[model samples]
Target: MTAFLSRNLAARASMLASLIFLTACAALPRSGPNKPEIYDGAVERGGDAQVIFVNDHVTRASNFTPAYGFSNSFRNASAVGADEIRAGDVLGLSIWENVDDGLLTSLGASSSQLQQIQVDSGGYIFVPYAGRVRAAGSTPDQLRQVITTRLSEQTPDPQVTVTRVAGDGATVSVLGKVVGQGVYPIERPTRSLSAMLAKAGGVAIEPEIAVVTVKRGNSTGKVWLTDLYAGASNDIALRPGDIILVEEDQRSFTALGALGGQTRVPLGNEMISAIEAIAMVGGLNSNLADPTGVFVLRDEPEAVASKVLGKPVYGSQRMAYVLDLTRPNGLFLARDFYIRDGDTVYVTEAPMAQWRKRIGAVVGTIGSVNSVQNLAN
Candidate 1:
């Protein structure tokens, strides 16, 4: 069937691409985990990598974004003026009452009636007699003037005040690598973002640097929460109604068979390449690892099938990108292939691995049965 061939071709192609992943991952020094220096210290790639060549062929390339004056649509300039107050904002109401000496029952500085006025849905607040004064769009000082003037009608001079309520709005959801998971209470309107995090007990250990995200509505922005903690980031202020989310740590992923620590790594928002991903997970156990076959089983067979069939039978369909990471140029491409939440990167075992394990299981079962028979006899 036409379907079957495409399926087989796709499978072969993926295996081959993974072949690139393995080959590329192997060239670096395998001293052990915590080899940040190996990748970052400028190493040369002079040796030949045993890359498995298959019908599948794709190469990738890219570089880091430039700093200064370049407009990244994702990172917008901070908002100004009343444009900052989003919906669901809770404001603080501070009232200063100048009590009349006559009305005070021997009490000094007593309020005429109520002290503070609460703002409503329409951004207006009604004081004791200053009924329905607009305050939402109005600045704190401006609102204060409005209240004072209105109260002046009753008292010769009524001292009034207005301020945003402390901690009365939506909260940030801290996911992945924190001790607690939920929306944290933000009591102050003008508090620094670091203060909000301090309220929720800061980030976890070795938290992925530059991997935190703040997502809301249609707007998603990236920040290095790890860097924020280490005093490396300047973009640390959290806006009103903003969600400050921490990404999952990197040590939660699974590395099977040949890997030293076969575990699941939590997904973070760092611009990390596949080579970097492999290094993050304790590197491969050289004795059991086959450099020519490091494969990342990210996509399922079903999805690859759809892609294959959708390709034109006449022209070359773009299968998928498999980079020869041994090349310096390949690292550039890996940076752009940003990984999202819940992505899986696998390192496949050697060809004869499963068969050996299967055979061992069968032999062990047979030996157990024979021993049982002998004991019965």
Candidate 2:
């Protein structure tokens, strides 16, 4: 009776363990069909879900928009050209007269009388004889000529020189994630944004992942540094008091599910196609991935969704995209289909992967039971 009771108890414990394992398997996220039919049926019998099948037609769609453009908010500073001297500029002025000591000339007066003068609100500078000449809106060379003409009236063979001692109004500030941070004087009439970036020791981040911004008073413009260099847009000329910022791109997409490893794929180029993005994450996992069930998940804009859905998808921006790589033409479409930032690229597992998973789980459960039986003995 004691031996019979012990066997009955062991049998009950094994049954209980089997029941627990089955329960756990049923509670898993997905089972049966490894890849859900998101393209044809799941999207069409939709409850606010948008689906796009990436193909030759979809690849040629003009739904993608550039992140940065020459919009009203973004006026290219290069179009405005270089920094010029304005009122409040401090000028270092010196006058020389080559002659015998006359009424206006003294032995030491030429060297001693080099005056540091600020351009007044009226844009004028004062000399001992020249008296309040308009210096505002004039270059140092232009002002020198004006001073020379005025001083020539009283002194014999008068020569004059003008240098900008302080140019607070005619300077650009290089800020944000750059190697150097300081106020750079805009000495030229036209200076490129690239020139300022070079002076600032380039950006801390790689050029591909750097976004260069130009802030001119109330107006501002931003562009990818890669775009700027690739001739997508003009190399904006900097203005006095403009703020140039080099910031991280901060745009990325996620690779999930059956990829080699889940990763955040940085949008390092002007545009990255779906195939390029997959390659960036080391392509999909060979053993586990479903070649026909590759999906690019994105939040479609209302307007873009309308084009794909044949009707307006108003409530939700969610979209699931399927790429059937089994077709010969599918590879071409993948190369052409642009991938936007914040997209989720997911490759569902092969049907065999699920079967393998179930087999592994069963084996593990059986192993656990045998170990328990050993412990009981």
Candidate 3:
């Protein structure tokens, strides 16, 4: 009777444990949803996001790679002369006459020096006898000719020389991520975008991730700092009243789920592949991550979405691209796949991981029941 009672109590305990396990199955701890759950969420009617498998075909169809490069306006622009004069410029004029008592010269001096002769807003400068010669549009040598001619009518063989002292007329403001930040004059050595950056003591950020922007009036252009030497066309001419900004690349993507790290990763190169992005976050969590359920989520532009789905899509569509690393060409596909800014790279939890949690929970419950029965005995 004792043995039979013991058997009955054991069976009752087993039954109770099974009931508790079933009731608490949904409450098990998990890092994130498993593969099946993600699929179900994607396929539901009016789903929040669509899931598409990553393959060579899909990679080729989705052509939404964004990069920084100058437009035609910047590429086609011609370099301006460094010595070109403009209004608001300060000039230094020297005048010498053959006669000792020359026009506007003292009895003992044969040459006269005019320091800091500022060009007026009307692009003209007043000379003793030249009478408001237009200096803003003329180069130093050109202005010299005009002044010499005007003075020669009154004074025989007047020698004139014009020198640019300083000016705010033809200057560019360099700001952001540069060794030096200030208003720089566009001279012969610093007339182009690349040259002007050097004048500002080069970019302070890494060249691989530096972005250079030039704004002139209503137009603006941008390009990677490394591309400045990639081609001559990218070395655009600098214009007066231009604003040049050198900054670190602002493009980044977020990594979530079962990965070594969960954070936003910045682009370290001009272009980065999906594999590179995964590595940036320390790859997948080997013990808990589902190798077959990696996903890249992004909002696809209308044109790219239409091509990717082979159907017309209106506006920006939410897309989730799946990558199965277990497939034969999975790693290769990932290597070629490109990651865009504002993308979410997620890896689902392995199914076995959840099962392990459930097993642990059931084992703990059964141990508790055994302890209670022993106390009652």
List the RMSD of every prediction in angstroms. 15.5, 4.1, 3.6
- Model 3 TM-score on a 0 to 1 scale: 0.90
> How high is each candidate's TM-score?
0.50, 0.80, 0.90
Find the candidate with the highest lDDT and give its number.
Answer: 3
**Residue 32 lDDT, candidate 1, scale 0-100:** 28
lDDT of 1 by residue, 153-227 (tens): 766665654555422333455665655666664444324455666666766645554256665556776556655
Once fitted onto the true fold, the runs of candidate 2 whose alpha carbons sit more than 4 angstroms away are 29-46, 62-84, 96-112, 120-134, 140-161, 230-233, 312-316, 373-377
Query: Scored by Cα lDDT, where does model 2 land?
Result: 0.73
Candidate 2 lDDT over residue span 23-72, tens digit each: 65675444223455554335457554566677666666524765773454
Task: Return whichever of 1 and 3 wins on lDDT.
Answer: 3
Question: Higher-TM-score candidate among 2 and 3?
Answer: 3
Structural RMSD, model 1: 15.5
Error of 1 at 274 (Å): 7.2
Candidate 3 yields a Cα-based lDDT of 0.85
